[model samples]
Every structure is written in structure tokens, then in C-alpha cells.
Target: MNVYLGLGTNLGDKEQNLCRAVQKIEERIGKIVSLSAFYATAPWGFQSDNSFLNAAVCVETSLPPYEVLKETQQIERRMGRNYKSVGGQYKDRVIDIDLLLFGDIVMNEADLVLPHPLMTERRFVMEPLAEIAPDLVHPVLGQTMKELNA
Candidate 1:
């Protein structure tokens, strides 16, 4: 399966954090096919003094969606990411790895959602995603990442 992931970091050696996370992903999950240029964006759905550095990655994984999510979460934990929120607020973190898309599969479970629920609204995700996968259409929205980025 071809998976697209959104990587963001606002705390600690931002670029290195992303590089290390991608390295770990390749080592544990699967091979990385492509990676987008890094982008800096303001925090969405919350406030934070540290702006987030975000990028998109495409990896070919044999693991199923749920397994992908599990491995990615483990990667985050290994990267020193902690659930940093106070009273339901998002905060700066060492790393955040979000599963943006998994092939054309659309799923909604308590623990996971495919095509990511908020990728369209967040330029941080769309921009980098478009960079790498401009023609990859969202199964739910039926639009290409380039269109969504617009």
C-alpha cells in the first residue's frame, strides 16, 4: 500500500526530528518513496509560541492501515513525543506523525480515520502533500491534493 504521512515538529532540532522520524519509519514500517520539501506553518486549531515545521512523505508499506497507525504512533513515542495538551489544547511537541492517506481506502474507527479528517482545511498538510502527490485524489472528497490545496 502507498501511504502518505504528514510530519511536523515545533520543538527541538525541527529538521533533524523530521529526518530521524522518516529514517525510523523506513527502518520499521516500509520504504519511503518520496518526501516533500519542509514547510513552516502556524499551529492550527490552537495557539502555540513555536511554529510547526511540516512536510509530507509517501511510503510503500505492506502493513495494513491500522498497523501503519500503530507503527507511526510508536515512532512518535520513540521520538520523545508526549501528549502535550492542557485542558484539551494542542501544544508544541517534539514530533507529530499523521497518516494523511492510505491508498484510496476510507475508514472510520474510534482509533483511526483514513484520508485524515482535517487535511483539506490545513494548508500545512495540503501544500506539502500537493508537492509530492499533486494528482493523488482524496477518495472521500473526490478531488486532487492540488485542488484541495487551492
Candidate 2:
């Protein structure tokens, strides 16, 4: 299965964190097929001091969605993520990895959401995604990146 992932870092060594994340991802998960260019953007949730360094990765993975998610969380922790604040989305330290899409699969579970609930709205995600696969369609919305960006 080919999957799209969102990567972001706002705390400490943003660029290195993202780069190391890519390496770790390719090391743990299946091979990385495509990777979007690095993008600098403002923090999305709670106002923060550091702007986020963001990018997207497309990888070929045979792992199931939940297992993939679990592995990603583990990677985040290995990179120094602290999941202390159990609540609505907020910024955190080190690397933040989100499983955006799992080969067009639509899932709305307590722990995961496929095609990323806010992927379309955020230019940070959309821009990088468009950079790599502008023709990629939203499985549920039936809209391509070009269509959505237009």
C-alpha cells in the first residue's frame, strides 16, 4: 500500500528533525516513493513561538493502517515527542508524524482518520502534497489536488 504522511517540527533543530524523520521512516516503514519539499509555515493550533517546518512523504507500505500509526507514534517518541497533553490537537516538541492517507482508504476510528480530516484546508499540507502529487485525488471528496487548489 502507498501511504501519504505529514511531517512537522517546531521545536529544536527543526530541519534536522525532519530530515532525521525521513531517514527513520525509510528505515522503519517500507521504502519512500516520493517526498515533498520542505515548507515553512506558522503554527496551526495554539499560538506558538516557533514556526513549523513541514513536509509530506509518500511511501510504499505493506503494514496495516493501525500498525503503521502505532509505528509512527513510536518513531515520534524515539525522536523525543511528549504525549503528555492528552487533548485536542496542539503543538509539541521534536517530530510530529501524521498518517494522512493509506492508499485511498477511508477510516474514521478513535485513534486514526484517513485522508486527513484537515488536509484540504491547510495550505501547508496541500502545498507540499501538490508539490509531489498534484493529481492525487481525495478518496472521499473526489477532488484532485489541482481541483482543490483551484
Error of 1 at 130 (Å): 0.2
lDDT score for candidate 1 against the true structure: 0.91
Per residue, candidate 2 scores C-alpha lDDT tens digits across 4-110 of 89899989989999999999889888899999889999988678888999999998998999888888988999999968335766865688898887898999987
TM-scores for all candidates? 0.95, 0.94
Q: Give all candidate RMSDs, comma-separated.
A: 1.6, 1.4
Per-residue lDDT, model 2, residue 43, is 85
Worst 10 residues of 1 by lDDT: 82-91
> Local error of candidate 2 at 84, Å?
6.9
